[model samples]
Target: MVKKLHKEGSLEPQIEDMINRINELQQAKKKSSEEMVEAQALWESLHRELDSLNGEKVHLEEVLSKKQEALGILQLHCQRKEGGAQRKNVLQECTEQISVHNCQVTESCRQRKLGVQVEEQLENLMSQHKDLWELHMLKQRLTWEIRALQSSKEQLLTEEKLARDKLLEVERRLRSPPEVGGARMVNDGRRRWRYSRGRRLPQTVAPQRTRPAKERPAPSAPAPAARTWSRPQTHRTRPAPSPTPLLRRRPEIKARISDRPPPPASVCSPIPNCFTNRS
Candidate 1:
């Protein structure tokens, strides 16, 4: 818009409009540069956030692996419990058979041998029953523990999945805005270059601008050299302070375009916390 304006116009309205357009373009450039700076700061913050999330992910994975190892150990215990229960059932069947045959022995010597055999078998059965009872109690406890770990593992898996989703979402947010800022800066840069190039003042304007410097000659320690000094220096320092402070402010506006290095501890505006504050 600023480029299309005729700065060499013959009328006052045209000149006024051109100046207005130039100011508007510069203001827009300033705004875009500020946005670019903010976006860059945000980009770095998001990267740091990404690193934090990655570390969290790794930590969670380690915890999950540990849980899995625990689950595996419980599974092994459960298997052993099952095997012991099966062995207990076989021993119980053998005891039942022995009891069923006890009545068949009737004679004196035979009865004595059967009686001794039955006493030994009863002792063995009592010991076996005690062991079976303990095993049953242990099995019950193990089952309860296994169920708890299974439930916990499932919960951990769910949390991991959610974290993964949140990471992706955050990364997506990180990628999008820089493209917009870059395009905005490119277009604004081009407009600023064209406008400045077209409106560059001629060498003749330098002496007029420098004439004010000559008036303030007390600061020019070598007052005699100041006359000869104005020629080379005036052209070089195109941004010589003008009569109006408004003209001085224009350079400040340009300075505002310079990128601000983001502080490491800079606490920015709160990003929407989808990861932690999810409804």
Candidate 2:
């Protein structure tokens, strides 16, 4: 009835309004279709996300179940281990205590041995030092003795040199002549002649007593021809050897040295000690 009324009155206006309503409905339908398509795509994406989440959950649940089983096994093993470890802990504790005690005993023994060795070493060193001191003293005494002997030897040498020089001087005096000037004369009651500067001098004779003429009858035994007197020639005499030359030839007098044997090995050598084991 209303459409008939609209058709009778202004049907063209009603038709245009109807057409606009239809176009609006068609546009709403198109918008609704687009909205439905977008919703469907969003729903599909959400469903896919849900499915992946569900798969991850399932996997996680399965892993959890396995882990729980493993945990149960571990708990049982732990119970067994706990029961066994009690005896093992006690045994280990005892072994450690024994080892510690042995180490301590060894340390004490080593310290005592080391102390004894140190004392022995100290004693040996002292003995060696004493021996060295004695040797040093002996060397000093010997050195002093040597020096004294050297000084005595020097003195003897000097005295011998002086004696040698005196001997040589006496030799020189004995070899030379006593007088060097003109010839000497010996005037006794009778005259004595001597050579002077390589020439012989005339001798003066003493006066003789006169004989009586009466006693002289045999003059015919003519007096022997007057004896011609010639001067005596001088002769050279050999000089005697000087005794000083022979006396001065003194033999080389060396000091008499007694050979002394070396000291015994016991006195000269050091005492021996056997090597000790370290372990």
Candidate 3:
């Protein structure tokens, strides 16, 4: 019975050790699952941040475009207002002068109707007539001035229209996708590198050169060996002969005939060999 108890004691420790090992494995598995969940959550947060940043970028671009358009319109309006103010000042000055001339004419007419001295009345009437003539001349000048101002206003309106068109063009360009302008999509880190390099990217890619299957030489063929020349063992002998000059042959020219007879001579001659003669 003592021996049996010894065996049982040994088995007990072994079973306990096995249970401890299983518990450790279970705990490790649980920790691994928890870490995986944490990693997934971090990735999702990063994705959300990226999406938010993209949206903000789009909003900022729209706002900037609108601001530029508004500034252009405001500038045009300010210029128009300045021109109108100048015209208004000229009109106000003319109005004041006309008012003074009317007052003088009224006083002269009143004195003449009251039958005071005829000579004095005649002189006053003459002065009034002179003032009337001046007023008539002033009216003609004012009419011409108004016409000129109208023309200037028309010209300014045309210029404003052109400016608006140009601004619209600029805004359209801004609104267009950057890819359409051959601009490259850059990552946040890469943009800094590009700025530091100060190099503009290529606007268009050249078409790739391709060799037709029939035109391509077989690659399995071995390359030719380089040529070697043996030098003379003796001291410097005769010098080498000079290279012969290469001569190019000139291309031959052919005369072409037309199928129809040429028209009668005119100021200009008919084009030569326009049609092929089949006969």
Encode model 1's per-residue lDDT on 1-279: one tens digit a residue. Answer: 334444444566777887899899999999999999999999999999999999999999999999999999999999999989988998898887776666453455587888899999999999788677656655654454456446544644565465556545645643343222112111111111111111323322111122343444454344343122232334455454222222333344334322333222222222232212211
Model 1: pairs clashing at backbone N, Cα or C within 3 Å: none
* Residue-wise C-alpha lDDT for candidate 2, range 41-156, written one tens digit per residue: 99999999999999999999999999999999999999889977987898899999999999999999999999999999999999998778767755664555456447545644
Q: List the candidates ranked by TM-score, beginning with the highest.
A: 1, 2, 3
Q: Superpose all Cα atoms of candidate 1 onto the true structure and report the RMSD in Å to 1 decimal.
A: 80.8
Off by over 4 Å in 3: 1-29, 32-35, 82-86, 101-279
Better of 1 and 3 by lDDT: 1
Better of 2 and 3 by lDDT: 2
lDDT of 3 by residue, 169-193 (tens): 7456444432312222222221111
Instruction: Give the candidate number with the greatest lDDT.
Output: 2
Model 2 misplaced stretches (Cα beyond 4 Å): 1-8, 86-279
Q: Provide TM-scores for the models.
A: 0.33, 0.29, 0.27
- Give per-residue lDDT, candidate 3, residue 43: 82
